[model samples]
Target chain A: MGIEFQNVNKTYPDGTVAVDQFSLHVPSHTSTVLLGSSGCGKTTLLRMVNRMVDPSSGAVLIDDEDVAGVEPVALRRRIGYVMQNSGLLPHRRVIDNIATVSRLNGVAKAAAHRRAHELMETVGLDSALAQRYPGQLSGGQQQRVGVARGLAADPNILLMDEPFGAVDPLVRLELQRELTRIQSELHKTIIFVTHDIDEALTLGDQIVVLKKGGEVAQIGTPQQIVESPADDFVAQFLGLDSARRTLSAAPRDDGGWFVSDAQGRPLGVVDSLPQHPGQNA
Target chain B: MAWILDHLPRILELSLAHLLLAAPAIAAAFLVAVPIAWAANRVRPLREIVVSGTGLLYAVPSLPLFIVLPIILGTGVRDTLNVIVALTIFGLALMVRSAADALDSVDGGVRLASTAVGYSAALRFFTVELPLAGPALLAGLRVVSVSTISLVSVSAVLGVQSLGSLFTDGFERGIVPSIVAGIAFTAVLALLLDLLLVAAGRLTMPWVKGGRR
Candidate 1:
């Protein structure tokens, strides 16, 4: 259930070093997020767990077994992968799309469909939509189907690559909340890759902030990174120096305190200050 | 008009002969071209070679191909097999390019998703790639079907029996009605086959019809 990347390195055929000496142990039943901007190799590190991209120089072990010894297809079957754009099969109906992995693993058609129906309910999709094609569904609904498909085989390790990146902001927030709800119930080992800082803070129990070439810029809980960035790069990446992070409180005529950013944009109005402000105990 | 009525039975016979030749050639061309197209689509070097090579094949005059195939296939010049083989070659020339384009039209995201979900390369091609490419492939097959039906008439120049024979015989005896009948029948046959391909596409690809997204 736990995944360990032992100094893994990936250099593309075109001489681009996407990942370099990346090592991390993703604890079982926890959500570990790899957070970085584009070209930071966050996705490459996530892919090594399932052998989608084999590491050029080091080993990736799942539950203490090196993945290199396992056949790529067999290894992939046991690992659930969800990608951006809700990569559902356009030709298949929602039920069949969710049932894809179960069928591939040789489950009976009747049982797979039965499980797919259950997963549809689990993902908050209506059973009435099960017979419709993916193209006929909204983007948010399609992503729900993608999540259902990823969980179809009941995989312990789920890799999600910007899984909610393609939807609208409102839908994305809803989906993020749904994932939180699902994870609480399932407790799967999830390795999620994303560039959005807020999303990383919201979902990650352990956040790995990656720099270029898969360098670990910082690795900690959201509070740890926000409170004490390891360096200036981490501080800047998290917008600690920006107006949004430099908030000030002003007395309002209504006796409430107005909290605003350095740019004077009102964030909110607080009824009262904390009783023990700035006190550690 | 009287001449067509007088030779109604003969016209019917020639039409049957025409279907026999064109139908098999169309089916054979599709079966052969898909694998070749898949290979071309997968490899860069093979794609260039196949595109240019098939272009040259298409450029070869059909009369000469009808005559020359007997020497290569070791069949008699007048045999129906020669015409069928010639039509199949012509169909392949067009079909290989179309099939390659059709396969290319499939979405890259969908293809990657299939692999991520544990489909093997071969299984993905038949299940994901091929079905997603269905509408485009059906369009290509329509072009091939119409052209193959029309080109079967060219074999009349090589003395092979088909609907084309009506054209030759009518011209030789100065019968205008026979030539007119031949053109009409060939047009009608092409239209019928094109409609069949469209219907088959609609039946198999239900996802495309009335899809909201």
Candidate 2:
């Protein structure tokens, strides 16, 4: 596992349990999403990995090593974190914002700027925006800059807390697609938190459905989750008809492809498949 | 009219000296107050102590401060040190308070963003926190400069002779035009100082103006 929570529990000073004995594993080089409504403790769980908020009890491990042992600031640098609002420093230009982590680690000023420039290109932002401050950028553009900044330090893991939540729907979709592309190319272990089910289905390699008070309602791939929900909560949480949605995963290939039953064994050709010449229907 | 004509050259010379006196006093007060304010803002314990101490210092009449300084720092505490000390104490409390408020009001998100990006406490304060707090700090400084000009005439009571000294002379001699000239010069200087502050604020805090637009 790239990151794992071992019996972690957190109760606020007011005696409200934000997260209960939560334990889960995120596989290396894959995106594991924490999907829930507000107050589900998804955000609280994400913050524990970097020790921004310490767990009341239990351990957070990165590659089986306890994150508690590492200095919070040092641990944070090794893990990229993106908040809902993008959280760009208004006083810093695009290039400087991207270079913030590198500069903090004492990278030569010129080298940091160069790295920022390169990352800006990688994220598909115009290099010309490099000199502009955060206030000058659009919401989508700011989020792009935030992603580039997160990746600038080249951390092995990235944590996102409703990263696209603040943007309008159109911009939100664009950023989500961009993030998916970044994940595919980089293959960093990612923990994405979102309230939107569509966002979870689209982004998660493995989805962790969190119940209120931080219990794991369910954990599985999209197909496994929809097809074989762990409990009534999962069914209700994901809404009804999840099984049909899971079954719809098979691609609509022509008679070149055939449908199969639960087993890998082929049953029959799909009549709904698009027709192809020189092939048996 | 003949007497006024004869004294014009001396009046100009004295006026120049008074300008000289007020300018450095204001500059020195700002120099001392800004860092104190910045420091007070950075350290919590110091903030209350420094602000309260400067407040107490400000309440001590400027005439007594000037008079007592020569006795404590030794007699002949004329020119720069005397004027600077008076203005520095006079303005310090307000500057520190302003700076602390400004720093406190800095957007919480900016600080969090800086921390998440791995910026050290010092780097974040200097680059992000301080810049964002620029408008408030400048406003504080404007208050300090204006206060300095108004309080500077108190030095005239020590016979140090600035614009206030002219007022003192006019009051003692009961000459109406001299009092008029003193008030006129001081008012004009206050207005000019205020304008310069606004201009400086504009230049340094473009983000504020840009945000408003």
Candidate 3:
């Protein structure tokens, strides 16, 4: 149900160490984002969850089982991943692209197509687009299809590597909001990777900041990350407006900050941020 | 012109033979070329070897290649099979080059996405790679079709009769109509074949045609 990385390290064949003994746990029904600059190993870390790129040392466990021992295809099928470029197969119809994972899982053609059409609707696409190929869609629409495809198999965990990085700013916001809505409803555990601090703050339930040398700069909720950074590296990496970020850390009546939803419903009282925060806590 | 109209059935028969010879050669070339092209695209070292090897095949004169095969295979020179052999060699070289170019041109993103979506290498080849490369392959096939028609005429040198023989006979007897008929028939057939290829390309590659409404 959750993903755990225990002292995982990745040294490329060229002997460059991208991830150095990194370890973390993403609890079920949460969105954990890996935020960093390019080459900080955020993407590599995400790929390790599904064994797209194997770690040189240590273990990646999904649902308490080491992924190394699982069949790569079966492991991947249970974890949905989205890349920056919505790598839609150019030759397939939009519907067929959405059904890729389901079909891979041995779903019959009729059932797979039916599920694909349903997912297209869930992702805010017109059913008419189902018959069209990926090339016919705009960049934003393509990313929507990518998201739809990722959710096709109902995986317990979703991994996205800058999924909206290629779309226009306006469309990117739309995708972010849609993802938020979907996460609220589906409660799928997600690990999103992005270099943009704004995207990190906007989408992350728990933000893991990676520094240039693949070190853990910080890990916290968006509010905690912005308001009370662990260090200068975290503060710089977050790049939030210092004054606004400080609002949540201002002294409170109960000697603890009262956390609230945007609608002002009190969620909890926190003396200090949890070492690892989960979404909608 | 009067004689051409008078013997339209014979003209039609000649046209049929031309189609029969060229179509099969193009089809055979297409079948052989795709695997060669796929190999060329996948293996970097093999790419040069395959390309140069196919290019060398292309460089060989059609008449000589055709002439040599029958002797090497111990088949008689006058057989239609020899003509098929010659046209296939000519068509295949073009096909290998064109198919390789087409496969190479497939967008890298598409291939990556296919892999991420759980398509194996073979599935990617058949479903994604081949379909996306359809237009290029068709373009190669078009060229092969045209080339086959032109090269198949050389069968006359081996003592088999074709439109080339009609031209030879007409020239020998000073009959201008027969020469004109041969020229017109071959030209018309090539034009029709190309048009058909264009249609097939459009149907197979609706995406390439800008995803027409």
**Predicted structure with the largest DockQ when compared to the true one:** 1
Q: List model 2 lDDT by residue over B136-175, tens digit each.
A: 8888878887788778777887778777877889899997
Q: In candidate 1, residue B50 scores what lDDT?
A: 92
**Candidate 1: stretches off by over 4 Å:** A250-257, A269-272, A277-281
Which DockQ values do the candidates obtain, in the order shown?
0.75, 0.37, 0.40
Better of 1 and 3 by lDDT: 1
Q: lDDT by residue for model 2 over A1-281, one digit each (tens)? A: 58999999999999999998999999999999999999999999999988878999999999989988998777778788888778988767789889888887778999999999999988889998887877888888888998998898998999898989989999888888988888889999999999988788889999999999998888999888877889988887777444323332155545344565444555556556555887888
For residues A112-139, could you state the per-residue lDDT of candidate 3 as single tens digits? Answer: 9999998888889999989887878999
Expressed as tens digits, the lDDT of each residue in A1-281 for candidate 1 is 49999999999999999999988989999999999999999988988888778999999999999999998887888999999998999888999999999999999999999999999999999999999999899999999999999999999999999999999999999999999999999999999999999899999999999999999999999999999999998999999989888899998998989999999998999998776866875
Q: Write the per-residue lDDT of candidate 3 for residues B89-194, one digit (tens) a residue.
A: 7777788989999999898877766666567778778988899889888888988898888777777666677666667777889999998888888888888989
Prediction RMSDs, each to the true structure: 1.8, 6.2, 6.2
Q: Model 1 over residues B68-111: C-alpha lDDT tens digits? A: 99999999988889888999998899888888899999999999
Better of 1 and 2 by DockQ: 1
What ranking emerges by TM-score with the best candidate at the front?
1, 3, 2
| Residue pairs with clashing backbones, model 2 | none
